[model samples]
Target: MLAPSQAHILVIDDTPEAIRPLLLALRGRHWRVSVATDARQGQQRAQLLAPDLILLDVRMPGMDGFALCRLLQASPRTRDIPVLFLTSAGAADERLEGLSQGGVDYIMKTCEPAELLARVQIHLQLARRRAAAVDDTPAPPLSPDEVVLRAAMRLIGQQLAELPPLEAIAARVGTHDKKLSAIFRRHLGMTVFAWVREERLRRGRELLADPLLSMQEIAGSVGFRSACNFTTAFRERMGVTPSQYRKGLQDGAAGKGTPAG
Candidate 1:
């Protein structure tokens, strides 16, 4: 792992006994480590702290870790935080679920303290590099396939309501999926799917400015499967519910019409 001089980490586990060895291992390592005893608190802390990495236990009371990880992925505020599963569940399906839910690594709690800390440090370092590259200022230069890129953007925007696959977008852009993915990543600093999601959320924000539109209509208009899904996605991306965003717009409009009172 990279130098741990200034990195911050969060551990979400139900068992206090399980956390002891980790705290011991991380002691004197100069990391800002915080713990949450359950998923709900873990989520709140994640949004507020924006820690670089999270060590989440798979099994917990109330919401389990898989669901919690999905919640993290849905929220734009904490979406990028790398989650390493501090779990004892060893089934292949369980591991698959963890990774699918956006966990970066899965480590059993029965392991030695050194192994635990080592995995934690490695993931934290990887996440640091990723955020650094993705958020780089003065983004990388565009490629010469300007025409194709324009075509692709137009296709995505036009079909956002349907939310077609990247392959479809590539096909419509007169290219293959691999090349399209490369171009998107090279020009946009993100994968094609990620950029599509970002664009959808951005467009959703614009649509939220219209008070006439219902949440279901807006969700459908932006290619979300349902209103509930849209709410989660919007909350994740904007750090607020869609209704709240619309209300803020209404509030701002009212403030503007107050006639300087």
Candidate 2:
């Protein structure tokens, strides 16, 4: 297995100026970086090197990033490599198409070098961890509907203190509330209310694990009207009080490190 720091990174972009900074960014981090000026050569390089990750641009001469992504997915040699699209396209549908075609994530071209490097490192670590755990198991690409659902879920996660109404979230994701409802029911077998409540409790549990936050603060953060309401909802989902759960986790972690007798 290639070490994450030494992993090969292939950048496929038609423009020389766009490629320069990206090359500088990854090579500076001690990664082995390769460049292809067009999608055809990029595809060839991808097959020959079987790179650890790919940074693809959307616009190229013959095959754009979206088309090349399909080709990559079709080939066993490059199917599992993570691809992050770097393009100026910011439309929701464009993002949905990119995710549907098997790209790991989409990034804007104008983003700072630091942000790009951080995203690259993060995905590389995740891919390495996944490869170590699984036997090159291919992940099913998300459908356009699933992409929208994910966008909605992300909005909810970000605004837990005051979640927008379902209508607002649907609008943000470029769908109607009724359509979002049907999509959720079809894919998740749950209504929006159920998903939201579960997400709140889930976040509450994570916040409780942090010793610095008070119960009242965690409660307000997760959208509960009061600490009592938060505790009641938490107990219902976790089958224990939040306080008990926190202490149990700390105790378990402490015991987990003790040497065997």
Candidate 3:
């Protein structure tokens, strides 16, 4: 359980000047504070810190707070942290969206410093209580299959460019190759290698949407050693070369009077 003074809060806001008052108020309470200026950085910080509370800006560049909140909910590590939406606009629809996206509270940036502090304290207390209850009645441990699946998936995602051999991956996740293959087939409807291939193509497709990345860079990123191999695989699965798919995307965007990039 987090004491009032021991609370660690993360403030995710792109506009530092606008959030200065909130920062000062939070600091004055003797609660530890961390800041992340963008949604990507905020997500990384949230997972790393697992702070007592999160004060997330509703609007951010690239991914908005709502999208970031959804990501947090998807992760097992940061899902329990309380998220308070910080906004200057205070629109009704925005508030509803924030709440629907799993925020615990919505606070106006223009609110009184004392009021903000009070709200922060309330949420922190609630988080502490929840933690205490969970401690009293602990959650069940993850099953072996679930643990292996999560670990293998995370490892593959982090090392797409140089994934280990199938036996090596299974060994790392504390299972043999045959058992791992069976697990993948049971849960993912495919063998481990097939899943990895699909994952690589999926990642490649996402990179293809970025106009700045060359085909070679995208190929290297998603585990293909050369652009030729990537193009062949992509064409076999997608019925078009990666370049053609990208051109289609650009063309579609151009037809709608929008820049593809």
Best by TM-score: 3
Cα lDDT, model 2, residue 247: 97
Worst 10 residues of 1 by lDDT: 135-144
Provide the lDDT at 171 for model 2. 63
- Badly placed stretches (over 4 Å) of model 1 are 1-3, 136-261
Clashes per candidate, residues 3 or more apart or on different chains: 3, 0, 0
**TM-score of each candidate structure, all chains considered together:** 0.51, 0.51, 0.54
Regions of candidate 3 where Cα sits further than 4 Å from its true position? 135-261
RMSD of each candidate? 19.3, 10.1, 14.7
Off by over 4 Å in 2: 136-261
- Compared with the true structure, model 1 gives a TM-score of 0.51
lDDT at position 37, candidate 1 = 95
Candidate with better TM-score, 1 vs 3: 3
Clashing pairs in 3: none
After superposition on all CA atoms, how large is the RMSD of candidate 2? 10.1
The all-Cα superposition gives candidate 1 an RMSD in Å to the true structure of 19.3
- For model 2, how does the per-residue alpha-carbon lDDT over 34-101 read when each residue is reduced to its tens digit? 88988879978987888999999886766577767766765666777999998887799989878877
Candidate 3 local lDDT, residue 258: 65
